[model samples]
Target: MELQKTMQRSLRSEIQKRLKENGYTLSKLSELSGIGTGHLSEMLNSSPSRAITVNQLDAMATAFGHAPGWLYELYPEECLSEGKISRPRLVPYLVRCAEIGRKDCIKAVVSNLLENPKNISILFSVAEQLFQSGKQKESVFFYELVIDNEKDSYSDQFVMSQYRLFRAVQGTNTEENWKAVIRFDSYWKRLPENVQLDALLQLANVCFMMYRWKDVEKYADELRNLATIVYENELLRRTSPKANDLLKTERHLVVYYGQGFLLKAAALKKQRLYEEAKQYIQGYADLGWFEILDETGQQEVEKFRVWAKINSYTLDMMLGNYEILPECITFLEDHPGEIFPALVTIMECANKYGFCIDEVLERFSEYTSYTEDDLNGLSASRHFRFRYQKAIYELQRERFNIGINETLRSLALADKMNHYQDFKQCVSLFEEHRHHASNSQIIAYNKIIEGGTQTNESSVTLVSSSFGIL
Candidate 1:
C-alpha cells in the first residue's frame, strides 16, 4: 500500500512539472487532455495521490510531452522497499544499440522516444549519429525537430549550420546550396554589421563555386561597403588591425574584379564577340594583375595566357589571316618546355594553311628530344599533340610506314602519360594496328623504336619499301 501511494504521488508531481513547462495550469491541462479538472486537482492536492488509471496517465503524458513510464519508475526506491515490481529503464540501452549501426535497434529507440517527446536530447543524439553515418535526410528531420522545440538554444543553430555546411561540401545542387547561404546570411545579418561581413564572404564563395558572378559581385560589394564603414570608424580602425588587413587582402579585390572580367569575356566569347573578349582580356592584362601573381598564381596566369592565345589563333585563322601563323609559331618557340599549347597552335596553323610538312617535321625533330627515361615532363595533352604533329608530318612526307612506326612509338610513350583522354587516343590507334599485325610483333617493334632494342629490321624494311623513309 505504501509503494502504491509513493508511485501515485510521484506520477502527480511529474505531471504537474510537465504541465508547468508547457505553460499549462492544471485546469487548462485537464481541458486539453480531456481529463476531469476535479480529478486532476484532487491528484495534485492529495497527501498521497489517488491511483490514476493507465489510460488516464497516458492521456496526460501525451498532452504534456512526458514519458508515463519515466514518471512510474520515479518511485523505484519505494517499490523496492515494499517488494513491488518497477518499470524498466531503456533509454540509455537503446542509445547504445543505435550507436552500433543496428537499424532495428535505432527504429525501436526512435519509436520509444517519440512516445515521450521530452527525451529531446536523445532524439538529437540519435540524429547526430545518423548524420555522422551519412544518413543526411533522416538527420535533417530530427534536427528540424530540435530547432522547432528549442528555438532559443545556440546549439540548435550550430547543429543546423553544420548540417547545411556538410551538404554544401558534398556538392548539393546550386539552388539548395544557395538556400543554405541565404539561411546563414539571414542569421548573420541579425548580428552587428562588422560581424556580418564574414558570412557575406562565405556566401560570395558559394556564388563563385556556382559561377554566379553577379551574386558574387553583389556580396563582394556589400563586404566592401561594410569594410569602408568600419575603416572610417576611428575606434574600429584604431583597434582592429585584423579587420583592416582582411579588408586589404588582394583576394577580396582580385576575385571581385578578375571574376567580373572573366565572366564578361566568357559572355562575349559565347556571342562570337572575339574582338570584345580580346579587349577585356587585354584590359585585365594591362592592369598588371597577371604579373603580380605568386608562384602558383603565376602558373595559373600562364595557363590562362595559353588558353587565350589558342582562342585568338583560332579566330585569326578563321579570318584567313596567315600572318597570325608566324606570331603563333613564335609564341610556341618562346615557351620551349611547355609543348602542349605550342603544339596545338602549330597544328592549328598547319591545318589552316598547307604548310611545308617536311620542314615542320624537321623543325619538330630539331626542337624536341626524348630522355633516357622517356618522361617528357610535358603534360599528356601536349605530348600527344607533339606525337600527332610528328606522325602527320611523316605521313605528309609519304613516309606512311615511318608514320606507322612513330605512331606505335607514341603508343608506348602514351602509356607513361597522365591524361586519360590522350591515353585513350593512343590506345585506340594502337588497337587499330592489332588487326593487321601480331600484338607481340607490334610490341617488339615498338620497343626497338623506343630505343629499348638495337634491331634495325623494321627500319631496313621501311627504307626498301615504295613509301620512302624520310
Candidate 2:
C-alpha cells in the first residue's frame, strides 16, 4: 500500500506527506535524517524546491523506517530541473541506483537523458566515476550505452568506453579475448596517453597468449617508445621552472618501460630470434637506475630483475645449451611459479633437439599433472602449451601411447579454454598419429571431437570465425 502511494506521488510530495502522517516536525525530521532544517524546508515547501541527492533520499528513507531505495522509483524526479537533467543530483542517483540494483530506475533515467544525444558525455562521465569507484560490472551498462549512442568513433569518451569495455570483458577464453582485441584495435592510438599505455601493454600480453608473435612485438615496441617519451617528458615537467604537478599513468612508469622490453623479448624468443631477444632482455634486466623509485616502482624493478634472470636462462635453454639444464631446474625448484612455462620451454627444446628428459619430467611430475589449482595464474595457457609440447616430444621419441594421451588431454583443455589455434594444432597432431592410437585412445579422441562439434555448432561465430576458422 505504501509502495503504491510512493508510486503515485513525486518524491518530495511523498516525503512531505510521510513527515505529516508520522507527526514529525521539520526539526524532528531533520534530526532523524541529518539534513539541515533550512534545506528540509526548501525541499518540502519552497515554491521551486531544491533537488535532493540520492544520499539524502536514502537518509530520509531510513528516517521514515523504510528500506534503502524505498523511494527510488519516484526519485528520478529529483534528477531533473524543468526537464533538464540535474547532473549533480543525477550522477550520484544513478550510481546509487546501480548499487542498489535498481536497473528499472536506471533505465528510465538513462532513456530520458539520452533523448538529447549530447548527454552521451554525461553517461560516459557516470561510467568513469563508477569504474574509478570499483563498480566495474555496473559501469558496463553505461559504457555499453555510450558505445551504442556515440556518433564520433575517434572521440575521447567513445574510445575510452571501448577501452574500458575491452578490459572488462577479458577472460580465460582465447577466442573471446581475440575478438575483444580486434574490436579495440583501431581505438588504441586514439586513447588518451595514460589509457594508451595500459591498452598497448594489454594488447601485447593478449597477443602473446594467442601466439601472435609479430603483433606482440609491434605493440610491445609501441609501449616501449611511448613509455620512454612519457618518462622523459615527466622528468622535464618536474624540473620545470614552475609547479611540480606529476604525470599520471595506470601503472608506475617503469612498469611500462620494463614490460615493454620484457614482452618484446618474450615475443622475440617465441619467434626464434634468440640473440635479438637477449638484447631486449638486457634492456629491462637492470632498472635499479631508473628515475623516481617509489616503493611500488622499486618492487616492479625487483620483478623485472627476477624476470631478466629467469628469461636469460630461458633463452640459453631455448638455444639447446643443455649444459645449464640442471641449473635451470634448480632455479625453477626455487621459484615454483616459473615451473610450467619452464617446462613448456624444456619440452619444446627436448622435442627440437631430440634430447631425453624422462628424468626431468619425473622431477616435476606434480605440475606436469593438469590440475587447475596447481597452475593458478598461468593455469590454462601454459598447461595447454606444455601438454602440446610434451605430446610432440613423446611422439618424436616413438612413445605412441603416452604421446596420443597427452594430445587428447591438450585437445580437451584447448576446447575448454576456447584456444582455437591450439585446438586445431592438437587436432592435426592427433590425426597425423591416429594410426598408432589404441582403441580407447581412439574413443577418447572421438568424444573430444564430438564435444567440439557441439560447441562449434552452438556458437559458430565465436568458436570459429572469431579465431579466423582455419
Instruction: Work out the TM-score per prediction.
Output: 0.34, 0.77
The window of 10 residues in a row where model 2 has the poorest summed lDDT is 461-470
RMSD list, candidates in order: 20.6, 6.1
Candidate 1 per-residue C-alpha lDDT over 1-470 given as tens digits, one digit per residue, 9 for 90 to 100: 99997656755566676777789987888887798988887767776655465456557867876544444334233222243322233333333343434445445444545544455665566556666565544455556556555545455444444443434232213334556666565455454454454455556555544446567556656765664454356345547655443333323332333434443454454355657766655533432343234565555455455545555664565456766766766775766544443455455456547565354446656555554333322222244566765665655566666656656656555444323344466556555554544566577656744656332211110000000000
Candidate 2 lDDT over 1-470, as tens digits, reads 99986467877777878988999999999999999999988988898887788899888999999988888998877767686777887888888888778999899888888899988888998898888886766788899999999999888899899998877656556777789899999888998887789899888777777889999989989999999998888888878789475567778888899888988888888788999999998898899988877999998887777778778876887787877888878877887766766777777878777888899999888877765434321356677888889899889889999999999989987886677778899999999999999999999999988884223312211111001000
TM-score of candidate 1 to 2 decimals: 0.34
Total backbone collisions for each predicted model: 1, 0
- Candidate 2 stretches with Cα past 4 Å from truth are 1-71, 99-102, 134-137, 152-154, 243-245, 354-379, 391-409, 429-470
- Model 1's alpha-carbon lDDT is 0.50
* Candidate lDDT (C-alpha), each: 0.50, 0.80
